[model samples]
Structure formats: structure tokens, C-alpha cells
Target: MKKIIILTLSFLLICFLFMQFFRPKIVNSPASADFQAPPNVKAIMIRACYDCHSNATSLRWYDQIVPVYWQVAADIKHGRESLNFSDWQKMAPADQKSKLWEIVYQISAGAMPLGSYTEVHQNAKITRDELSTLKAYVNSMAAVALPDDTAKINAADRQYSQWRKEQFLIKQVPIAPNGVRYMPDYKNWQAISTSARFDNGTMRVIFGNNIAAAAVRTHHIQPWPDGTVFAKVAWDEVEDKDGNVKTGAFKQVEFMIKDKEKYAATEGWGYARFKTPKMIPYGKNALFTTECINCHRPQKNEDFVFTQPIKH
Candidate 1:
């Protein structure tokens, strides 16, 4: 029995040694650009995010070991594809801001510095103070040029009235670039949640179709059953001097249709957006769904959904 055990241990050791030679090449490059931020914010991001997110990855000795190395290599590759702070110089100004905001969202959601990563890199754990620093930095850039003039606000009000009038007219429904048709009946569905975007001066109401509504009521929402569908409609938020706020012009409506088998590539949800009263569809082609999927990645644990339904 002792001899057999020895042999088994020796075989396992040999296999582990051999696996090291088959490791995926870890590509480390000098960062072409460094993310610009205050010293505190920069330090936090470097400690928590640089491992898989930046080109200058400081891997530990244990990370260089066999099977684990393969996962780290793959993670770095996918992470860079999602957002590479090292290549920040290559991104457009608007894109840089968008990615920074996304970083804030992902971090706040506890979806970043992945659980697998933080398990090994204990120093990557973010503290509450660090989170506040990051949030404050991002909020400082939120100077949204909303419709400030009374003329423009009145025009938006007029547009809202015209939009309501158009609901009665039977017309050809617009289809998105990805083939999702405009779901007009969503207006009558159960509104499950509301989101206010102060940055854009817009308010969004999320409505769930019958299947989705049923899922919410039954608490079957962790993965949310396959047939579930949600519609999020956005409109400008008009505010009076008295601090009262109301909806202005209709801006856009987005949908998330679930089908694990069908939308397997897009995290089990088909996304579509229709903008303006004209109902002009968003996206240039089917591939535009990637943008939606990438934005939803941080909510992967919640089945790529950002909203928590208001229980019936």
C-alpha cells in the first residue's frame, strides 16, 4: 500500500512538471499609456486592477506554476480585450471616460478584480475609502449639458405630447439592426423598477413582460427563466424651479430578451434599442450586440441584468 501511494505521488509530480512546459506564453508589454488620475485613485487601481487589466502585470511565483498559469494568461487576454488601461492612449477621449465609468460600476458591483483573482492576490482587495475616492473622481466629471433653456424645455414638452398622440396610430413597427422588433405593447406591461441618470438628466422605467413579471413575483430571478423579457424606456427629466421633476421628450427604449440557447454568444440575452419618437433603431448591424454584452459583463452574476425588480 505504501509503495502504491509513493508511485501515485511521483506520477502526479511528474505530470505537474510536464504541464509547466505546455503553458500559454504570458505576454508582458510596456504600457503605451498610463491612466491619468489623482495619486490616491491611481494607487488603488494599480493595487487592485493592474494584474489582469494592464500590460505591466506583476505575477507572483505561484502564478507561474502549471495549470494556474494557463488561466491567468487567458484571463489577462480577455481582460485586455474588454478594457486595457495600458492602452488608454489608443482610446478616444469619450471612450476613455466611458471605460472609467464602467470601471466604477464594475467595482461598486463587486464584480471586478475577479473573485478568482482576489483569492490569490489578497493585496487587490479594495477598501471602502478607496471606493469612495474612485467614485468622487468619476463624479467630478459629470457635467452633463442638459436642456437648460426654457425654449428647448418647451420643445421637449411638445415632443412628449406628440409622442403620446402617435400611440393610437397603427404603423409598421421598427426593427433593430439585430432583428428585434419594437415592442409597443411594453408600455402596458408591469413597471418593475425605475432608474434616474443624473449625468444625462434622464429617467428610465424598466417594464417586464408577462413571463418576466411572473419570474419576479415567484422569486425565480437569480438566473431569470429563459422566456423573460424586459423593456427599459428613457425620457428626458424636466425639473421646475420648485424642484419638481417630470418626464419630457421620449428618448429611447431598450429591450433585453432572454434565450440561453439562442443568444448563447451574448450571455443569454438579445439587446435592442430604439431611439427618438421616430423609433429609429440603434446599432449599425447585428455585431453591435457586442457593445451591449460588454456593458452587461459586470452584472454577470445577476444574469447580466442591472435592475432589481420591485416585488408585487
Candidate 2:
């Protein structure tokens, strides 16, 4: 028995030692084109996102060890594929704009600076001021004076509005006189994106209609053009025996309907929530509009929507 135990320990040590030799090569490559940002904005990004998303990764002692190094390597690999700030200018103008939008959306949704990464580097968690700075930087990119190609987003808004009104007349679902309704044909609509909110105990799938789809495809995210409508359905998440989580019970469904002329009282968008199949509207006398805007205030620049276009 003693000899067998000694052999087992020796094998384990050998395996650990072998893993060190196979560690991923951590390289600090030169930036293809140095991405420029305001001093404060650059500082925040460096502290929060650089390790995973840039070539200038600074790994800690444990980050160089075997199993942990494996995870770090994979994260950096996937992160660069998503968006490499080091190669920012190498991307086309349209791609740069799209990437900027994604950065703002992810940060606003509390999806970036990954939770696991922030667990150890607590300072990496974004504070409100830093988040605002990052968002402002992204918004500034959108405001830059580009050629007619990127500048046409404004003209496209009017065209989309006329198109949306036509669709609304033909296909808009109705609610009862008491403001109750059932879920509409959202599954058939264009899927905008999906999101999970660990802080809220829910996962959501967002859908957009023809008008919203056109606007998103055109990259006209702000001011949201009239007649745009969105449907977001959320569900409780349940963990299976394998520790994988899946959508459990139906939690709720919400809608954001945009009509600049008619819904001008609520920032040109009307909000509604249905907590059950009965589809009773959420909230009491003034609570709905007030609460909806308050919750979405952080994403005001994205036209009060948290979901961004899913880049295929």
C-alpha cells in the first residue's frame, strides 16, 4: 500500500511538471495601428480591458501557472477575436463604428471586464464615472463627420419611419380595452440579440420587427426612427445536473414601441410589460413610464435599448 501511494504521488508531480513546459507563449506584439483615445478614457480601458483585449497583456504570477494559464490564454485569444484595440485602425471605418457601438453596449450591460476577471482584480470593475467616460468616447466616434456613406444614417431614419408606419397599420397586435394582451409573433421576428443578467436572475431574448431590423442593419441606432418596435422576453434560469444553465420558467415579456409624434410624452417611446400569459400591463398610475425610463437611462445614448445588433 505504501509503495502504491508513493507511485501515485510521483505520477501526479510528473504531470504537473510536464504542464509547465506546454504553457501558451505569452507574446507582446507591436500594435498594428495605435488606437488613440482621451487620456482618462485610455487609462480606464487599460486597467479594465487591456489584459484580455489587447497585445499589451500583463499576466500575474498565478496567471503564468498551468491550469490558470490555460484559461487566461483562451480568454485572451477569444477576446482579440471579438475586438483587438491594438489593431483598431486596421479595421474598416464601418467596422470601427460597429465595434465602438459594441463596446458601449457591453459596458452598459455590465457584460465586459468579465466577472471572473473582476473577482481577483476588484479595481477592474467599472465605476459609474469610468463607464460614462467610455460611453462618451464611443458616442464621440459616432459624431465624427464622415463621408456621405456613413452620414446617410440620418436620411435613412425618415425612410424607415414611413416604412414602419405601413407595417404597423397592417400587423400591429392589439391589446384589450383594459390594456391586457397576449404575446405576439415575436419568435418570427428578427432576433436582435440575447442577454443574461446575473444580478437580476434572468435571461432575455430580444426581437425586432421589419422596421427595427432595417434600422439596426443600417447601423442607425440612435433617435430610433419612428414606428420602431422591440419585444424582449425573459426567463428564469435553471441549472441542470451537469451544471449547465438553461431557460426555466417564463419570467416576463416587455415591449418598446417608438412613435415620435404620438408617444412624445415618454421620450417618443412607449414601454409595456406583461408578467404572465394574461398580458396585464406592468405598474400602476405613472409608475410604468417613469420606471422604464429610469431603468434605461444608462443606455440613453443607444436610444434606451440594451440590445445591440448580433454581428454575424
Candidate 3:
């Protein structure tokens, strides 16, 4: 018995000693000034995603154990390869948009952080509101160009034309005392509005800007031909640090455009808005719909929209 006990103790001691040498490479990336995260989004990511997907990992003391160390390293490496938060900005604009949408789909489906992960890290489990907030942010980031479906486009165009004509009538009518000017084109009239129209017959309208006249003139004023479709591409304004209001900047919002429905499982559009000085290839008003759809099929009910309805 004494001999057996001695051997057992010796084996345990040897295993512990060997574990000391099993050090996994730490995951961390240098922080950049441009990489800003909304406070809530930042919190959830740190608690759940940073361990695998980011350079900012918070390894536990037990992870130093030999066999565990191997698992930890493997998980980190796989996480980074699948989706590395550290290298997000390095990807093309379209790629960035698609990934953002995918993140939402995974979280909503409860597939993120992996079940094995949440088992050890209890806090990694996402709450209902956190999921909703994440969905909202992802949706905002993915706001993109209008769909290309002919039927939907025609309907949207008719609505836009009616809205424009109503605005014209409002402009012609006089206002009474205490009655504010009901400028139907108030959104377009805003300095940083989405009034720019592309030659392909699409209208870009910002949340608050007036460019209806400009869009009409540029697109050439005429009623839509039968079967002609019109889709509305829209966005909110981006704000600065000092609380100064800036226009034409991309603010994340839920994007449920016609093309998303038409394309269904095939594809979805993704969009993001940054500051004018950022010098992004697409400029402040750039749209990237083609690249967004490939990943959005992961969630079909929401019409490729990432904002999953929080099940009570």
C-alpha cells in the first residue's frame, strides 16, 4: 500500500510540473483610435467574444494546466480565424458589413460563444435585451441600397412620387399664425440629407434633409413607367464627440428593403456610414448591397434583417 501511494503522488507531482510549461500564446491586438464601440456593445463583446475573437482575452488561472492549455489555444486560434474582431477594419467595406450582419444572426440563434464556451463562462450567455440591442446595432450597420425587384420598386416609387407631389403642394400653400410650415420635403431640405440620386434611377434620402428637387431634376421628372420599381434608401445622421450634429454620416438602423425580400435566402444588402474624412472608397453615401446577402441567409424570417424579434 505504501509503495502504491508513493507512486500515485509522484505521478501527480510530475503532471503538475509538466503543466507549468504549457503556456498558450496570449491573444491581444493593439487598440486603435478609430475602433470605437458603443458602450453596451463593448460590454457584451468583452464578456462573451473577446476570449476567442479579439486580442483582448482574459484567460483564467486554470487555463495554465497542460491539457487545458492545449484546448484554450485551439479555441482561440479557431475563434480568430472564424471571426477576428482585431482585424475587422482591415476587411473591405462590403466584407465588414456582411460580418456585422452575421454576428447578429449567430447571436440571435444562440450559436455564438459556442455552448461549450458558455458552460465554463456562465456570463457569456446573452440576455434578451442584450440580444435585441445587438440586433439593433447590427441592423443599423447593415442599412444599404434599395432592392432591385421591379414590382416592389414600382410601389415604392409611387409612394415617393405622391410624397414629393404633396410636398410641392405644401410649399405652394401659405401658413397661418401658429401653424408651422408643413414642408413635406423637410428631410430632403436638411443640409446633410440623402437627396443625391444615381443615374440608375435610385433615390437616396437622409433622415433629415431636403433634396427632393435635386433628385427629381437629376432623375428627370416623369411618372414611373408601368412596372417600374422604386426603392427607398435611407439613413440616420452620425454625431460627433462634442454632441455636435453632423449629417450624411452613417448611423446604424434596421434596414428592411424590398430587395431583401425578393432575394430571400440568396442575398441581402449591407451598409455603413463613416465620417467624410475617413476616405472610405465608397465615400460618405456609398452603398454595398451585393456583398451583404451571402451571409444574411443564416436568418431568413427577418427578411435577412438581423434585428431578431426578442421572444418573450
Which runs in model 2 stand beyond 4 Å of their true positions?
A: 1-7, 144-312
Instruction: Name the best candidate (by lDDT).
Output: 1
Q: Give, for candidate 1, the lowest lDDT window spanning 10 residues.
A: 162-171
* Global CA lDDT computed for model 2: 0.71
Each prediction's Cα lDDT score? 0.83, 0.71, 0.51
Error of 1 at 113 (Å): 1.9
Candidate 3 error regions (>4 Å): 27-29, 33-35, 144-312
For model 3, residues 113-217, the per-residue Cα lDDT tens digits are 777778888888999999888777766765454334455445445544654454222224332122211223333443323432221122344332223234333
Model 3, residue 244: what's the lDDT?
37
Candidate 2 residue-wise lDDT at 55: 91
Candidate 2 matches the true fold with a TM-score of: 0.50
Cα lDDT tens digits, model 1, 1-312, are: 999999999999999898889977767888868788789988998898888888888889999987888999988888878877788878887677667777877887788989999998888999888888988887777664443567767877777776655652436798988788888888878998886664456788999999998998789998999989999989988865556677877888899999999888788898999888778889999998998888788688889998876436
Pairwise TM-score winner, candidates 1 and 3? 1
Ranking by lDDT: 1, 2, 3
